[model samples]
Target chain A: MSIDTDDPTVAAAPDPEPDNSLGGIFRAYLAKLRGGEVGSLPAVLGLIALVVVFSSLRPEQFTNSFNFANLIGQSAGVTVLAMGLVFVLLLGEIDLSAGFAGGTCAGVLGVFLTRQEWPLIPALLAALLTGALIGLLIGLLVARLGIPSFVVTLAAFLGLQGVLLTMIGEGGTIPIRNDFINGLNNANLPVWLGWALGLLCIVGYAASTYITDARRRAKNLTVQPLLLWALKTGLLTVVVVAVVGYLSVERSRNPALTSLKGVPVSLVVIVGLLILLTFTLTRTAWGRHVYAVGGNAEAARRAGINVFRVRLSCFILCSTMAAVAGIMIASRTNSVNPNTGGETTLLYAVGAAVIGGTSLFGGKGRVIDAVIGGTVVAVIDNGMGLLDQPQGTVWMVTGLVLLVAASVDALSRRRASATGHV
Target chain B: MSPLLELHGVEKSFGAVQVLRGVDLSVQAGRVTALVGDNGAGKSTLVKGMAGIHLFDAGDYLFEGEPVKVTNPKDAAALGIEVVYQDLALCDNLDVVHNMFLGREMKRLRLVDEDTMEQRARETLDGLSVRTLKSVRTPVASLSGGQRQTVAIARAVLWNSKLVILDEPTAALGVAQTEQVLRLVRRLADRGLGVLLISHNLNDVFEVADDIAVLYLGGMVGQIDAASTTRERVVQAITTGVVPEGGAA
Candidate 1:
């Protein structure tokens, strides 16, 4: 496997393979490809280990299909919000205002649709645009005014909180009146339709891989072994299908009580976003530029890249995503209130991002990591609730898991650095 | 014919510290020029001025014998002058193609054209005979020093640069990697591009360069033919700031 040449740190590690045996050599090659090529395998596995530990603690509830669906629905907002956070974080900036952005946007959208009796389309656009503008203003302050993003965004966080409180008014609650928009929280495609969609997505992914590899191989180029490539794609397919089935089962079971269970429309939007972002970052040039700027701004600038444009773009993306998550939360509650977003939601979003394997230092991360990390958080939350643990215990447990994930990322980065993997 | 790039009586400073003092350098087409100097001898300052990162205090920069005042690095790039900094400015998380086209990616409808980018990246690397690399998709963090240097040079050439400035490409490379890089430098000059290579390693300078320029304490000491120069004399010029034949500063 060809190693990444940009990071001298990870590239400096001594070659660990010299054996010629077929089995041993192949395993070592896999490790090199999987471990060093795309971030870290340790962090990914650590996330799983955390999930396993939580499941073992409350096997009857955590491992159950109903609870697994609950986890997905519960984590959907945080996951989407964290995805946007990853963009800003990878640029080595903090958007502490993410929670507040979501809260204010959600409240604003509710007011537009319910109080003003506006249509859903205009209300949604206004909410998202407001969030984007907030981020744009913050970007301008940091990029042009020479203020640090941390300070600029922090001030925004506090200011947005006050705005949200005022918007909620002294009563502190406003119910959404629009039918089509409010039903987004309760809506779901049929279970079989979900399965079909899952299959279609998996098939599309496999086809894209086959076509790209075939074209490359026809030119006598270096293509990854079919077996290795298939192994990863197959795993992705299985995980996706299983998640759909679990959500479907939960939806079917809830019909016995309130007939109110299914894959929420917000969840679908979140998945669609994941696919869009993954394609943008991995398969596009702007994604490459973003990674370049994050990796080394000076180097990127010298290469004739517009460093300012890429950074500003990241902030815009991040705030727009937070707005979407805020809309989802508001839809789920069917109400906007002062307490819509708080310290708990903000901490969870940040934790989910770190757990997803985005580097605290920037220039390394995946959108998929956010999804997995969000799931891990939901697993812990849903399982602890089943065990009847106090809210404090839930917070402590999540904090510990977040700490471990962060430690894994830090150690791997040092390893990558020491080995000249830069 | 006149030199491809000419720096006539250039003077530059940073803050209150004077760095380049009326330095004049001429790089002819189809030849390798080596820059040698002591640690604080203003080599970086002179190069930075030419690269447009630092505007000269007083100088006339001529391209094709016409005086041109460059405002920034962007102008230099548009004029086909590419400078590969000592640090190389590569992002490890990105693949070779991504690294090569970091800021200027080919996109259609706001999406990167991966297939075409990969095709071109492969062609550039292959043309250079960079055999050490296994795949264009491999992250740069995994390449050996020699391979990483190859990627940087390829990127400069791919952008259709006329003059290439490499800052100490072999300083931290191993023996094999150094040999690989020196070979690439020789090939670049053979392609008729003007190459200004900065190196402390006399061995590398002697092996690849056709002409050598020496600097001492923010001033040009002398420019001599590489074939007629010796490592000992070069070291002496660097340390004692005396060329012995009269042109010291």
Candidate 2:
């Protein structure tokens, strides 16, 4: 009954508790995988496999720095959209209208910026406001009116597409001539600045980890071994170094004319968002309420959480992120058309989330999961194009990849339940 | 000494059906009061009324000899009354510490204070002499039925509650687990907290209860002393809504 006093005899005796050393942590991780808490393992392994396969098939083209940078720009929109979807899916809800919702917001941006001749910031704000308003309406219907989210968002999907078409006129496109907006996807940081930022990321990650471990240790709580922490930091360091190194090299077709070097601005934006969203989801009380509601709405309500407010907020954040994604896509293409966020865009975003190991069934996901899954989606599309494959082939392969990811999610969920870890 | 909680002539009805009719109950501190009855005996309705989930149509609800109004769950909570329902409301995805401090998490700088929460949770569990849990960080999904019940009970008393009400806490547990939970329930009373335990199991009622309050047809049969009453007499009261002549009341 007394937890404070340590018995000298017991202290002298062999410790019988489970090990908390580095090796023990590794074993525990393996056991978790076996128990079907596979998490991001499958996605990481698949990404590696795809990179190896594509590099072997198109040795010169796929391994080049130019294509590496292209991949980041291509994945930016889907990654941003998937990040939003992660929040919605965490509540066992879907936002089918997110894609067209993005398009509609982009159309608003086009009308404000190109037609009305407004400045960048105001037009951007107007676009984001449009996104928030759409989310508010959808959230109202889903949370307050008690309509099924699937039905509400599905209706919104069709309605938003029509709204976009009407704003831009049927088959019309608005060319974006704004340099700052275009620079989002096409520009790069200076090589020196890129290195500085990359190093800063590594330092920041290490500092945060050290501070958390120190606090936990100060409280006499169970803390992972220092070796495990070092290993994780080392891994992140390697990744950032590799990406920054690759991007720092001159990848321009004509190095004498223009230097296409340093990390893409879109990549920096995405990483910033990833850090912010990850912090929000892991550290904040509102984030915990989200997971609680996702896990068991009844339990959350009984615990005095406003389940409806959590539901409404998630939808609002999802659509706002979608609006950001729409802006990025428009930046990449230098224009806003009815098709800006139409066709395979929403599917790719959802697929990215699922493929990154975010569960379709609520209560399991992270912001980083969407980023990893988005990269996997981008690689498939990029690789298929390099292979000179038909558009049909690319879509089929992407579809099959999504299907397999979903099957893995379902099977792992079943395994988790069987092992009493559900 | 006055009872920690006393309900006098409590009446409740839903539409045309009157679920409870002039029921009386008293729970004393440092004692276990077992409320027993058969199906549709209005045990749940009575407890819900006291919990403010359903306000009694008419009654004198007194706490520490003071008349109080409990119109909602928040009011009941403010009065230091906590209810652990039969279903044991807990989020499986959250760990024991998180579940214990679910909606009422301690925050520092607008972020959940994880270190403080973990420390408090460990201290609370230790104070209850809970040694079955190896770590407070284990997810509720991975815990056994008995452990989950323990967590629920621990959560009920976390807020320095004056009275704790549990509905069928052992109904879904095994014999060994049932014994574990009953011992914990008794330990709660030993800590000078009033405990109102609603159960159908006679063995449980007789094992830890100091007072036995029988409900029949939405009416109180009698609140009898457990040590002086026979099981047959209590059973008779439940079945016929009348106390036997020789029964201690």
Candidates' C-alpha lDDT: 0.79, 0.90
Best by TM-score: 2
Q: B1-249, model 2: which lDDT tens digit per residue?
A: 999999999999999999899999999999999999889999999999999999999989999999999999999999999999988999987889999999999999999999989888888888888867767877777677788899999999999998999999999888877888999999999999999999999999999999999999899989999999989999999998999986757
After superposing candidate 2 on the true structure, give the runs of residues whose Cα lies further than 4 Å from its correct spot.
A1-20
Those runs of model 1 whose alpha carbons end farther than 4 Å from true positions after fitting are A1-30, A33-60, A250-262, B13-22, B57-59, B65-67, B108-110, B216-221, B232-249
Alpha-carbon RMSD, candidate 2: 3.1
Clashes of 2: 0
- Kindly list the per-residue Cα lDDT of model 2 for residues A216-289, writing each as its tens digit: 87877867667788989999999999999999999999989977999899999899999999999989999999
> Number of the top candidate by DockQ?
2
lDDT of 1 by residue, B1-249 (tens): 998899888888788988888788888888999999989899888888888888888988998688887778888888888888777888776778888887788886777876677778888777766656656776777666777888888898888788999999988788878888898989889888999999999999989999888888887778878887677778888888777663332
Give the DockQ-based CAPRI class for model 1.
Answer: acceptable
Model 1, C-alpha of B15: deviation from truth (Å): 7.5
DockQ of each: 0.42, 0.50
